[model samples]
Target: MKARFTPALFAHAEAVLGQLLRFDHPADAVVSRYFREHRQLGHADRAFVAETVFAVLRRGRSIEARCAGQLSDRRRLLATLALVRGWSQRELAPVLKASEEEWLAAAKAMPEAELPPAVRCDLPEWLYARLEQQFGADETLALARAMNQSAPLDLRVNTLKADRETVLAKLAADDITAAPGALSPLAVRLRDKPALAKHPLFLDGAFEVQDEGSQLLGFLLEPKRGEMVVDFCAGAGGKTLLLGALMRNTGRLYAFDVSDKRLVNLKPRLARSGLSNVHPGRIEHERDQKIKRLAGKADRVLVDAPCSGLGTLRRNPDLKWRQNETSVTELTVKQASILEAAATLVRPGGRLVYATCSLLSAENDAIVGAFLDKHPEFTLLPASAVLARQGIACDGDVLRLLPHKHNTDGFFAAALERKA
Candidate 1:
């Protein structure tokens, strides 16, 4: 049901937007905190506030361009409603101040074609320039357009607990619409975002809320039933559960991370996943003794190295505003170090997959290229071939899933095998 907006709800949304514009914390965190503080908000009320605030964030640059000298959170919110949400000026008159009427009209009159290219794309100048150089101006704009929109909720079925068909049937019985995802055979794309925290199927761990693109990474590793596998940087054990299920819960799968809190968060999910093969461990750093002991013992290792997270703009638009070029450059250095450390775990003839949820080449292709140059013992495997073996059709030597092309979060993965 559509949330009924009142003057008070608008006040709540405006206050939340004001806080978010500070950009000191993640957008989700800020909104969640606000909701916690204001427990009086109904579910639909919270959803309305969050959706409105995120809409402004996604088109922040564009909305600011229109706001010009009169920039304020309220103005941005008004402009977003009028310009993006298709709210007629007549509909917005209930909350608009006398002075804002003319401003809203003029803001709507601002020609988008006349705005700067970066503003038009709703991206930062440096990010837009880098993307343009890599993908050309037209393609970058297309990518930005895709990223600026809301992302669909994609789920991965845990084969260890339930099959896709059964899960689909259950969702149908519950009146929750979903369909098979185009990319991963185990993927289920939901038609709408629903609160699944209390859903019996989700509580039972029949499936997980994983991006379809991320699910492909497990396919790249292809852990065998008795093989030892490691998910380096397994934040919250999303892929760890996937690898354990892929191995049919018969092999040892280690979930390692630097954050104890993230590993702690995985415990509940791990219990629901019905996987006995996963071992969660916290490490001080990439070169910690825990990782050192596992060197040359893993049959498959997945380094889903942390990056700038620019690829997740559709879900985390705040990141584009929070992350800058310097942060990305710093991340590249750390990514190289982590990839190097993780590669040491792969035994001779074992497979290693280096992946990132980053669109920048420096984090994806460049890191893999430099790794291959330094490590003569590891041969770059054609990602297309490996995915094809599992009935996935990928065209590139590396697996690159773009939001514009694949309707999944942007992802890049390269598969490598150690020479025996």
Candidate 2:
């Protein structure tokens, strides 16, 4: 049967929304299952349905509040389409009942002042409070506004395979537009999202899709050509690949993570990038025997700790609603423990880089501050100096990139060097 605007899309959307709202499944999983069950929807139809449903989820609280507790799944979807998606009643008349016009008018007139801060900012109260604590009134508003926008696609040229200029030229030749990134020499901002999986350059291992902010983390580590380095939380080896490329595939780059699934995912990327130096290790925990064996031996280590993911709102807006105070508190403890354990892998005089895709200072600065207080031998090194030495000029002691300020995911990175 053909799926159309009359009933099919709405039906699938309602089912998808029910699954998303009722259960704790990740948004991607929910969407994937929906697509798998209804494989008849084409790419354009799928995109519309998925994007509309996501917009609703991102602003569910606000939309529900506008409906004044009279919310049904259909009404909520209609409200979301009108308000967030800017669809007029006439535009939706084909799908909505004739009786819904009055309700849509009232929803359209819903005052911003009447809404709670969380609804206004499309964030949870706990998340807003934490950001308020970290950034105060003005900056938090700015950050929230930035997070509401879509994220751009970025690519990191694999120097071991090809230089940035060569890759850029090849990409241009293929009619894929990209420009040099603001900070990292290896980073390039693509004009539009393109599927590069089967592209000649990508297949040849000329580049990898990585955010510029993430690429900066590699620069902060400043791994030497032949020194042993470890990406302590190298999920899917995003930073691990960058570090491996930086080391010119000469040094051993240990990619450690608790997830065997994530390590397994990195294997193909390793082959694509031609990184012969990477060692993907699945650790039982932060204190796994494999990790302990490398204690005080690494020349550089990166702790891209698991975080609230507040900084990645553009890519994963659902996180703002999913994360709560209790969850953040649990993560902070884990982050601190991971940093402590990862620091041990760095030899005296070696560097440990701490990074997270979190806008909250509690996860970034506070975690590092607490770690510094406990470990006397490690001293904070200005991230600017570290990047400058690597020919990447960025300001501030800690490298902070907000979506609004840098047009990248909100990220914080701090470099620490151990004393001899």
Candidate 3:
């Protein structure tokens, strides 16, 4: 069905609301599957259903609070349209019962300050408390609000084949209205999200979809043309492609991950990337013996360690509900172990860049601190200095890219060099 800004579209959103609330998989994946199964939905219809479902996911706690705590999936979807999208009762009357309209009006009129802090911020209590400690009360709320909003699409121009100006011009000629990214020199920020899957530039390996913060990690790694490099935890090889391009496709870049499923997805991207230096392989874990020979051999190693994915809330809002402190605690242990194992691959005087898409200190700064404490041969390289060499300027000894601060997904990276 080609849905409009009509009640029928809202009905479709309501139908899938419960599936998202169950949190069996990511909301985006669930929504994609729903559209795939229901092939009758038009692009606008899918967009309407997706946007409404995401809005509810972002503010479920607050929406439920407004609905007197017993709201069903249908009511949650309706409340999202009314409160978040600002749809008027008259516009919604096409699908609502007479009594339902009255209830929605009451929900919309509820006082904001009456709700608890966590509810007002639409965050769970544990998450709110943790963020409050680091960001303080005022800034935590500010960060939460930023995360609740939609993420803008960011693409990194393949410098080996095309430059940023050239790509920006092409996008402009196509009426895409893109501009140079403020942070990463390789990045281009689009004014509006468009499907670039079939664009000529994408098909020809001119650029790849990467967050501006993620592009920063490649810069921090700073792989040279002939140096050996490893992208540990290279899920789908997003960063591996950037690293290969930076090496001008002259270096041996190994992309290792635990899942063959993820490694398989990387094959197409590696082919489209127009780079011949990358080797994608599946590993048992960070300690797999396949990496033993590479120890003390690689010129640079990037441990883009697995994390809670909390920094990507703008794109993956359901992660907030799916994760808790227990999961984060377990991840910290794995992250530390992986970092220690990947550090072994760095040759003397070679660089090791550890990064995470997490907002928490335990997964980022603390882990780095513990590693530095245990390993006397490695010394910290200032992230600001490394970024400055690449024509990007950001403050901090470590690269801490927060959504509120950088307008990119939250990321933390520390560059370490093994003493020669």
Candidate 4:
């Protein structure tokens, strides 16, 4: 249910947006901090504040274009309500001053077509240019429109504990509306985004909050029972748990990352997962001695490389504002280095899947193409054939999922097989 708008709720949203506009910290972190400090705010009020602030973040450029004069957080929020949220002038009068009414009316009357293409799509010019070059003008606009909206809550049923049908039934029993995801068989897409932290299904690890696009990566890797698999750069072990369950918890699945804090965060999830074969380890880097010890021994290695995270804009609208060409350039270098190191762990005749939640070609195809040129032993496997073998339908040399096309986060993955 939508929170009933009040003057205090509007004040709270404006305050949060002020901090978020600074963009010093992650948007979620800043909102979380605010919530922690203000324990008095109820769930509905907190939801309203977060949704309002995020709406501004997702359409800040468009909101700015519609407004005249000095644009403060209050004006941005007002414009958002008027233009984006479809708040009628009658609806907004309760919150508006007489001086602001005419200005807001003007903003509401402004044609979005008058703005530049990037502004109309609410994308940074540099990023919009790159996407336009990659996907053309029309496609990029559609993609941007999808990314600017909120993402649906997708859950991956942990096969080790429960099947998709069982979990769906349980959710239905609890009055939560969900349906099987169109892409991943194990995925269940919730109609409404509900807090599931304390849900019985979540606590017992019957399902995990994961994107359907992310679940596809595990099928690409296709780990078998009793095999040795490596999840290189496994942050908080989301995919790692998926890999372990796919292996029936019989194989040794190593979840390696540079951050000890992220590995620590994985502990509770791992426990809830009921998987016995997952080994969480902290590596100094991709070339750590620990990684070198297992060189050429892994049956499968998945490199879910870190990128600019532009593809997750639906949930993390702040990333587009926070990331720039310079940061993305640096990420490409690290991604290349990590992919190279992870490739060494895949045994001859084994598989390696390089994947990312990035929409940029610089971080997706370009990196893989360059890597293939350097490593002759590794041959690119058709992503469609791999997914098809697992009963998932896809059609391409690589798995490229766009939110507009797939109803999932934008993802790119390429499977490679090492010659025996």
Q: Judged by lDDT, which candidate is best?
A: 4
The residue-by-residue lDDT of candidate 3 on 9-104, one tens digit each, is: 776788788788889998888998889899998877887788889999998899899888778888888888889888888777777788797788
**Per-residue alpha-carbon lDDT of model 4 for 1-420, expressed as tens digits?**
778788888999999999999999999999999999999898888988888899999998988888855698888998888888889878877688889998888888889989889999999999999999999999999999999898999999999999999999999999999999999989999998888999999999999999999999999999999999999989999899999999999979999999999999999999999999999999999999999999999999999999988889998999999999999999999999999999999999999999999999999999999999999999999999999998999999999999999989999999999999
Runs off by more than 4 Å, candidate 3: 1-3
The Cα RMSD in angstroms, rounded to one decimal, for candidate 1 relative to the true structure is: 1.1
Q: Between candidates 1 and 2, name the one with more favorable TM-score.
A: 1
Model 1 pairs whose backbones collide: none
lDDT of 1 by residue, 105-199 (tens): 88889998898889999999999999999999999989999999899999999998899999999999999999999989999999988888899
Give the C-alpha miss distance for residue 389 in model 3, angstroms.
Answer: 1.0
The ten-residue window of minimal lDDT in model 1 covers: 66-75
Give the worst 10-residue stretch by lDDT in candidate 3. 1-10
The TM-score ranking, best first, is 4, 1, 3, 2
RMSD of each: 1.1, 2.6, 1.5, 0.9
Each prediction's whole-model lDDT (CA): 0.93, 0.86, 0.90, 0.94
TM-score of each: 0.98, 0.93, 0.97, 0.99
